[model samples]
Target: MRAIVVTEHGGPEVLHPSEVPAPEPGAGQLAVEVAAAGVNYIDTYHRTGRYPTKPPFTPGVEVAGTVVAVGPGVTGFAAGDLVATADAVGGYAERALVNADRAIAVPAGADLRLAAAALLQGMTAHYLTHSTHPVLPGETVLVHAAAGGMGLLLTQLVKLRGGRVIGTVSTPEKERLAREAGADEVLGYDGFAEAVRDLTGGEGVAAVYDGVGRTTFDGSLAALRRRGVLALYGAASGPVDPVDPMRLAGAGGVYLTRPSLAHYTVTREELAERAGDVLRWVASGELKLHIGRTYPLADARTAHEDLEGRRTTGKLLLIP
Candidate 1:
């Protein structure tokens, strides 16, 4: 099977195309003929050792494909079933293994590439808006990098919950994309906190969905209202520095939490609910996914470079 292997932990150059043995279904797993693999920030973290993954490992965790085989003890799925999952093992390959419990059925006629693009980031958006802080009707929130894949999803989902979104983007094009995604207002990164405050009449927002860490952490806190929540989910700009707990008190009792998909989808039921809602929305066109680019499996390195350099918006996928 063809795959991208992280020969060493360093930079995008380290993601090498290699011919590796195809993975098979183990107990409770499904062997999938990979249609597409999602290129995400976590893959870069694995490649750069920021997430502490060992070298010589395949770098994708999200995939959508046809089931080639089902392992022992797995039920309710079989060969030829189209499925998607955020827990695909070695997903950046021609074939990958997915635990049956973690797999979600792709609706009939749904696009496999979009399934791969939507599951991970889509479910992350689900847990953030539906569970983390639970955006209330009429509440206003801030989303950083609002034109990026996750940002666009968050913007739309917040609006679905009847919340107003103030999004921060780096460019005019991104601002337009954010507005299209339902952001009430879009501002450049420069002094966005002040802009957010002015938008809310100096009260700040109810929450801030911040995926870009380091550069935006302080401003995210600054943009929050009293007792507001700051959900720090990703570190696209770089990881945030350690903080003093006392700072939360000074920031009007604002709450700061670092969330991960694994923690939110700890049970199969939770995974199904989140994945189901996201896929259903995609299928019905109630939710939109902008696939920024698709690369041949061998161009994984370039995908990482473009993503890390913040040169692309929307979801990126690798076709096998």
Candidate 2:
């Protein structure tokens, strides 16, 4: 079997496609014939050594595929059952071993490719809007990287809760994408804090969902009103330096938290609950996903390059 192997972390060029022994399901896992693997920013962080993954490993963390074999003690899923998983690694391969407990059943009506593309990002969006901060009616949310994968979904989810969305985008085209995703206002990086404040008539927002760290953290915090929440979820611009408690107090007496999907969905029931909502929205046509790019398992390098370069928009997939 073939898979993308990152022997050393450095650049996208390090992702090499090579023949590898096929993975077999162990106890409580499923041997999946991976049809599609979701490409997320976390994979970029892992590949470039920013997130410090152990050497010589597969980079992807999410996948959708048919179960070709099941481990012992695993029931309710037989060979040929289509499923998706978000917690596993080694998804940038023709086949992967996924934990049965972490897998979510994909709707038979949903396309396998789209489900794979949407599962990880979609569910992350779900938890962020419905759990982490829980955007409320008439609340104003400033979502950074609003044209990106989780951002687009998050923007829509915020609007679904009747929150006003103020989104940040890097380019003109992305502005359109964010607006299409339901952002009430979309602005570029320059002076976006003022734009957000102006949009809200100087009252500031109720919350700021910032994934673009370092470069935008201060501005996002500044855009929020006193006592508002700042959910720092990712570090696309590089990790922010440790902030002093006094800064938070001075900033706006704000509630600040750094969250990740893994920590948010640690339990099986929580995973099912979040994944269920994502799948339901996907099935019901309430949430739309843009699968911006697809790369063959062997071309993982190209996928990573495009993603890190910000050449792709929305969700990217590695098709096995």
Candidate 3:
């Protein structure tokens, strides 16, 4: 099978295409014929060694495809079932192994590309809005990089919960996209904290869904109201520096949480609920997925570069 292997982590140039042995389904896993793989910031992190991994590993984590073989003890899935998972062992390949427990059945007519695009970021949005702080009606919140893949989803989901979104984007085009995604107000990254304060009449927001870590962390903290939550989810620009606990207390008694999707979906039931909602929304057209671009599996390096450069919007996919 052809796969993108990273023997050493340095940059996007390190993601090389190579021939490798196909992965087989082990106990409680399913081997899938890869249809599409989702390109995400985490993949770039893996490539750059920020999130360290052993050498000679594939770099993708989300995939959607048809099952080719089922392992022993796996139930409720067959060789031909359409499935998607955000927890695949190595998705950037012709074939990948997924733990059956973490896999979700795609709806009868759901597009495989959309499924691949929606699972990881979609479920992350789910846990962020539905579980982490639980957006309350009439409350206002801030979302950083509100035109990116995860940002678009977060904006729409926040509106679905009847919350107002004040999004921060880097350009006018991104501001337009964020507004289309239901952001009540969109501002440039420069003076975003002040803009948020002005939008909220000095009350600040109930929460801030921040994915752009280092560049937006202090501003996100500044934009929160008393007892508000700052959910530091991703570090697209760069990882944030260590903070003193006193900053949280001094920032109007705000709460800071560094949450991950893995911790949010610890059980099969939780995974199913989050994935189910996102899948159903996409299938029913209630949640819109904007596919920014598609790259051939071998061009994984370019995909990483485009993503890290912030030149693409919405979800990016790799067709195998």
Candidate 4:
């Protein structure tokens, strides 16, 4: 098997490709012949030691493929099952092992590449819109980086829930994309808070979903209404500074939360439900997935560089 291994924490150069023996599934695991792997920012964090994983490890968590071997004690799955998982490790390889319980069956008509691309980001958007704050009809919400993969999905979900979306983007092209994804108002990152205030008649939005940390954190806080929730889910611009609790109180008693996909789908049942909703929406065409780029597995380094450079939009995939 050919896999990209992170031998040390550093730059994209650290992602070195090598030939190795294929891994066999352990108990309660399935060996998947990887068809596609989602390239996410978290993967870059792992490669750079920002997330603190040990060296000499494969860096991927989401994949979709056919099951080639099922290990002992695994049930509800067999060889040749088309499955996808957001909890699998070593997904940057041609083959990866997935815990059977964590794997979700891809719907018959769903594209495997789309499945892999949407699993993590889709579920993240699901919990953000449905659980974190639960956007209600007539409410207005702010979404940062609203033309990116998660942003587009979040915008669509909020619209489905009847919330009016105000999104921020870095470029005019991204603003158009955000609008197409159902954002009622799209603004440039500069002066977005003031724009949000103006758009909402100075009352502010009901909530703010901010993934671009550091650069937009303060603006997100200012864009919210009294008691509005600010969900900080990523640090695309950079990691935010340590915040004081007083900041929340001063910001109109607004709520603040930092969420991750793992915490949102901790249980197998929860994982299935969230992932199923996302896949169902994709199948029904209610939610569109923009797979902006696809690279061969060996081009993982270039993928990381492009992602970190913010040179691409939508979901990026590595085809194995």
RMSD of each predicted structure: 0.9, 1.2, 0.9, 1.0
Which tens-of-lDDT digit does each residue in 45-144 have in candidate 2? 9888888899899888899989899999998788989999887759899998889999998766568887787778888788788888898899989999
Candidate 3, residues 245-268: lDDT per residue as tens digits?
999999989999999999999999
lDDT of 1 by residue, 225-247 (tens): 99999999999999999999999
Query: Scored by Cα lDDT, where does model 3 land?
Result: 0.93
The models' CA-based lDDT, in order, is: 0.93, 0.87, 0.93, 0.92
Give lDDT tens digits, candidate 4, residues 181-296.
Answer: 99998898889899999999999998999988999999999988999999999998889999999999998999999999989899988999999999989988999999989999
Candidate 3 regions exceeding 4 Å error are none
List runs of model 1 lying over 4 Å from the truth.
Answer: none
Model 2 segments beyond 4 Å from truth? none
TM-score of 4: 0.98
